[model samples]
Target: MRCVVMFSIRMDMRVILFLTLFTGLCIADSKGNLALNGMAVQSSLGHPQGDAQHAVDGNRDSDYKKESCTITKTEFNPWWRVDLGNVYSVSNVTITNRGDCCKDRLRGAQIRIGNKLDNNGNNNELAATILTAPNGTQTFSFESVNGRYVNIFLPGNDEILTLCEVEVFAVIDTPSYICGPRNLALGATAVQSSILSGAGAQRAVDGNRNSLFSLGSCSHTNADRDPWWRVDLGEKYKVTRVSITNIGDGSAARINGAQIRIGNSLENNGNNNELAVTVVSIPLGETKTFQFQPIKGRYVNIVIPGRNEYLHMCEVEVFSD
Candidate 1:
């Protein structure tokens, strides 16, 4: 009886060891990532003229100015990611870095996978890090994870994220739109350095397009150097674009050199804020839109530098995502 019991115990130990080795082998064999082309890719911010879907369009071009991929300004915890649409067992994530410039921008990037929306899906389980050479295409394989969202985030100050393409090998599912938050400027307050009587600052954002604030309905500033008009978007947003409709009848030229600025500060009349673009020309009575590499700000200012011209805007529109 004792000999039979010893033989059974040895057999059980051998089985356990074999199972452990077999599981390891299975994971190793699954290291080849599943291609995730055509997935919905998004970023914390997007340039106004470019869409976020470029990261998953299967294009490997990395030129920042090409508008084919996503790029974010230097900020705290910049992130970009993809949504698999439905939960799937993700095997690995492969990232294609910008081969043209700023290759070092991808180092220390953390690839996270989970379903949570907290912190824009960044507060998830970390899968891997781009610790090796930060250029070209690199693959990071890991244990299979069940998730609908796969995010790549750079944590810390002044982290700028740029992605040419991201491929996820996973059990397949169709993706949904993953754009960032929408326009948050509808009911915010407005202020100007000076306002002409009868044309309050509120006219610019009253959702009225044809109504001219300078034609007795729009806000107007005195003939002071650096005449400025501003709108408070109520809260900070990842500003994607700003649109302004110029009043016709030869009044549009007054806004020709105006600078569109955005930021959290009101210093230097908000001139210290980051400059998005300068208006070269806007056709008479036409609405012109200016886009930036999505910037975060609560205030949007349309100011003519170097005083003596009235800052007239018929309508101002802001959009995110």
Candidate 2:
């Protein structure tokens, strides 16, 4: 009887130890509605009484008869959009239509997500379409798209674009590369292949996301083939993510197609290192976060390969574990 009790106690201890280790390894995917409130919104017109800020105020009281949004009387492809402050891997978008009337006004509304501001961001990539749901909330889900701007456009003449609430659900990631708790890219040495004007490479590592890599705040390459920027972390570490902030107000296109690479290699401008993520595009003044399974490296590089296009960087941050 004594031996059996001792064995039972030992087994319980083993089980507890196993459970604790498993819990430590599991990291929950932080989930929440990213577009809850306090996002910048804009609209084409302010007549019929509607302000763009009403769209993201988390109010679902969509009574068109009441004083809600500044509505315009039906025009050509009238659009409304919200700037989410940063680029996000969007999962879905929920729109609240006017419960009182004009729910059909949202028919054929194209939901676009991208960085392009041409045509009031209507020219960007289409993620989903707004279905007609009268006096109710409708959620449109896409296959995990990425963007900083979310626009709703009714592509027709004399169409009213009325929105009560536009809730965007995105995978919000902690900024591991910025000046915050999980920041690992702080105070690193940055260098670029060329410098344009007074913009040097160190501005990227200066921990300021406001500096534009375009005119006078970031590093730029002049007449250089495959302009590249790199950061040295001084010591070898296992990198987990890399985030880049693009210039605001329609300058994000400058960093499109840039490749992020990480490794200990210095040959060929560190282009031969482990490939991180190819930046398809980033929205204006938004940070695009790229994740990896923790690659070990001391050098990180962002290069616009095979193109003579100038390299621009407002900020570049690297995260390591």
Candidate 3:
């Protein structure tokens, strides 16, 4: 009788252990970071000083998507580039429109960043226009706070995105995000290559130089008012960085907001819905780049909640810690 009792007690312990492990895996697969500690995250709209300098890009990768490099659709026309330097701070940025011949000069333009993006709401968070140059290359920086991701939109008058060179500088001692909500301790940032759509959408690049990013959508011309998209990283992963490029559909297209979330999906109205998660949005597209304070999980959901038309989503990327 005593021997039987001992055997039964051991079996009970093993069952408990198995159950705990199984539960942990389920949470990791489902709620992701929320399955752990994702209950205390807020939006960072009015974050302090988040504007930085315009930088230049060097051809680092054979694929041109490796390290900070220039990407020009045409040759020497408007050769555009970006520099991924450690986060410092800045105020304004100046760009040199190195037009080839015929004063292929630049005209009006706008800057983009993480904050200016909609935080899943109609919150108008905009970085100030420090300076504009229709004449020549100039410098710009904003000191309202600290920001790293930067982009200068030189709306082509005719058909000229002729970017010659892009130069960037820094200010703050620490990387931005100190005031922003994404208090991420990042490793390296990479752009998810072709996998930007379909399944494996949320999958990020390996710590290696893997060019693959699948988040949010580029620009949807179909104009599905309630248009939406999602990402699945195969297995759960630790997300700690982001970089986005978006050119809102039109001037009146107010729905260029990004509703970002983390969690597992359960069935939705007709499809699956991201359940038990933490979500936030940034209206303006990622000016240059955006990093979050390391959140452990796998799935990330980007919802638009059906707003404006022509509200295209450009390159949506995520990074592992």
lDDT of each: 0.67, 0.68, 0.33
lDDT per residue (tens digit) for residues 122-151 in model 2: 888989886655458888888777766788
Each prediction's TM-score versus the true structure: 0.43, 0.45, 0.33
lDDT agreement of model 2 with the native: 0.68
Scored by lDDT, model 3 comes in at: 0.33
Measure candidate 1: CA RMSD.
Answer: 20.8
> What's the lDDT for residue 225 in model 1?
82
Clashes of 2: 7
Q: Across residues 1-321, which tens digit of lDDT does each residue of candidate 3 receive?
A: 000101011343632111122111121112111111111111111112111111233211212122222223322212121222222243444454533332333444444433232322112223344233323455555554343334444334233333333444433233441222222212222222123124222222211111211222243333445444444555565665555444333332333454555544424421233332222433443333556665555555455555533323454555454
* Off by more than 4 A, model 2: 1-31, 46-48, 172-321
Q: Assess the local accuracy of residue 177 in candidate 2 as a C-alpha lDDT between 0 and 100.
A: 11
Ordered list by lDDT, greatest first? 2, 1, 3
Between which residue pairs do clashes occur in model 2? Answer: 47-71, 49-69, 49-70, 50-69, 50-70, 50-71, 51-70
Q: In candidate 1, what are the lDDT values of residues 154-263, reduced to their tens digit? A: 87898778887777764322232121222344436888878767566777765444434434435666776888888898778778788887876547788889998999
